[model samples]
Target: MTETFQISPEQAEMYEAKYVPAIFAQWAPLLLDAAHVTTGQRVLDVACGTGILARSAADRVGPSGAVTGLDLNEGMLTVARRLAPDVEWRHGDAADLPFEPDSYDAVLCQSGLMFFPDPDQTLREMRRVCRPGGTVGVQVYASLGSQPAYGPWVELVARHAGPEATRLLSTYWAHGDLDELGRRFDTAGLVVEDVHTRLGTVRWASADEMVQVEIEGSPLIDRISDAQYTAIRNESRELLGEYRTDTGLQAPIGAHLVIARQR
Candidate 1:
């Protein structure tokens, strides 16, 4: 059965400040490289949270090129606008793009495709707007199994959040399987050119630092009541303790870089 998903404004803002923003920063260059963005290419970033990737693309494309960022969350757009005022920021859904066909030379989506209610429809919309021969690039978490840090966070939240945790976590995690990704692209009339996997690391000064990041920066933290917050934090700390090292707490994160072209 399909799971119902919802994210509050406050939760969205928290995500922007914490892991989401940092993770995007870590992968922005690789994503841009995969998209092969040139100096004069028009680019579109769907679900451009805080404009990390959008702003990065803007820098690469230079003044000659234009970048447009679209997101459903006004809060995120506000952040993106503040960060990159020169780029266009629009409030919209990935499943239905507002621009005309053949509008963008390249389209980039970072860790946003999996949250889409209908990923196929979203990709089709991306294809429709992208100019022929333009590239469509997307990045998704490889899988929960591959990420050590996220697993603990998921476990802690699931224990305290019960059913709600499942819904929230489902929206943010995925495995990078080419077959599945290719099938989605094929349905959208786009051909998958490359699917690359990258390893990322999330480090914290200590277990407490990690727990605080999750507590203050993750949407899952706000969903639970104050009564349950301490329990969740303690459990997350315990889980993170396993990964602690002399230097810090280090956890493995992986993602799939999928690049496609309209067929």
Candidate 2:
């Protein structure tokens, strides 16, 4: 049976509307700029959940340029289509994209490559569909330790959820091994142009709001029981109390942005 978290359209919609725009959308511009996405360039956004990066690319490309969003999840694609019908949306896997070889000028896979079954296969596929000299840019969360407020947050969840919490953490903290990532890219016929750490701020009015988003909009919620959720929430209030202020709270989240050329 499929998991209810990632496979559900309703959950996807919740994630997109809440967590995506709130937490993930800030990096869209940086990823686009890294790829040097410009007007009149054909771009492909692989595993474009909710089309945040795809729609951002669409805007960067202008009317003359085109952007296509692809993902294996119909639930995600459905939401993508409804949000941005103007951009082409395809239901497909990152391991094997549907487009022809050398099809796109640039390929952008933001915060999606980590979830692929085989990152090597997906990287090769991403390179295969990109024109020579074209860029492939990918984003992934920095290790949990490097991220703000994530360590204790994850630890508390682990205390409750066990091995499954580790799996959930893997999704967020995936691709932390930069050496391994570079090796994978090399195997996929991509030459690494740059690998860097970037910091983005996650804000919330209070710890409660943070808890709400992390629970309601997270894929890990499927594994967390009501009791566990309540416990985590209470702990979050105290653990993240430093971030709580009169106006809002800001936590610095970091990501590894990999820019490579298909050689």
Candidate 3:
């Protein structure tokens, strides 16, 4: 039996609507490029939230090739299915993939590495499903301090909402150190071909919307109080002032990209 991860429908919808466009979409191309995804090739997007990466992979591979997105969250899979019914979606644990061995030409994971209970096991599973010499790409945020606006946001949340809230937000940037991550790949028996940092910008209509999405669109939903929300907003307005633009709260965000080949 497969283990299911639960998230609210509203949160899943919010993630598809706000987080994907603002953040995840920007990194899809990077991962695809690193994996060298091309036409007529089987691709698996592990932890494919809302299926942006899988949908993008589908476009690259065309109809001849196949793309499957697997995630633990049924709610996310629901939204993903609604968005792109053509692509296959599955709900299962990342640490334990349900597919057969050597099943795909390439396997890609985006911004989902940190949250896994056992990242090394997940990478091992990703490698197991990829054919020998095929590509396996993974991306994780560089670090909380390295990311622009979010670091301060986490700090502000800590001040108001306490350590648990801060921990929830900070998890986004976990598993940042390159050496440590590379070792996990090494331990998983994946041959590291390249590793580097990629940067993208996050823009929200306002600091409030940015904060709202980061909190409400995540597990932090209902975990914070109205007074706390008010404090976070008021402080972020001044704290994140430099990132403000005509469009919204814009800031440079970065992630470490790893391209490894199955041996």
Question: Quick one: best TM-score, which candidate?
Answer: 3
Model 1 worst lDDT run, 10 consecutive residues: 1-10
Q: Which pairs clash in the backbone of model 1?
A: 142-175, 142-176
Candidate 1, residues 1-54, lDDT tens digits: the string is 124244565766676676564456788899999889989999999989778888
Q: Which stretches of candidate 1 lie over 4 Å from their true place?
A: 1-17, 152-168, 203-235, 245-248
lDDT value, residue 170 of candidate 2: 60
Clash pairs of candidate 3? none
lDDT of 3 by residue, 43-94 (tens): 9999998999999999999999999999989889999999999999998888
State the displacement of the C-alpha of residue 22, model 1, in Å, after optimal TM-score superposition: 2.9
lDDT of 2: 0.84
Candidate with best lDDT: 3
Q: Please report, in order, the local distance difference test score of every candidate based on alpha carbons.
A: 0.81, 0.84, 0.88
lDDT of 2 by residue, 31-147 (tens): 998888999999999989889999999999999999999887888988898899999999777887899999999998988877776889989999999999999989988887767
Residue pairs clashing, model 2: none
* Ranked by TM-score, top first: 3, 2, 1
Off by over 4 Å in 3: 1-5, 8-10, 156-166, 215-229
* TM-score of model 2 vs. true structure: 0.86
Better of 1 and 3 by lDDT: 3
Candidates' TM-scores? 0.80, 0.86, 0.88
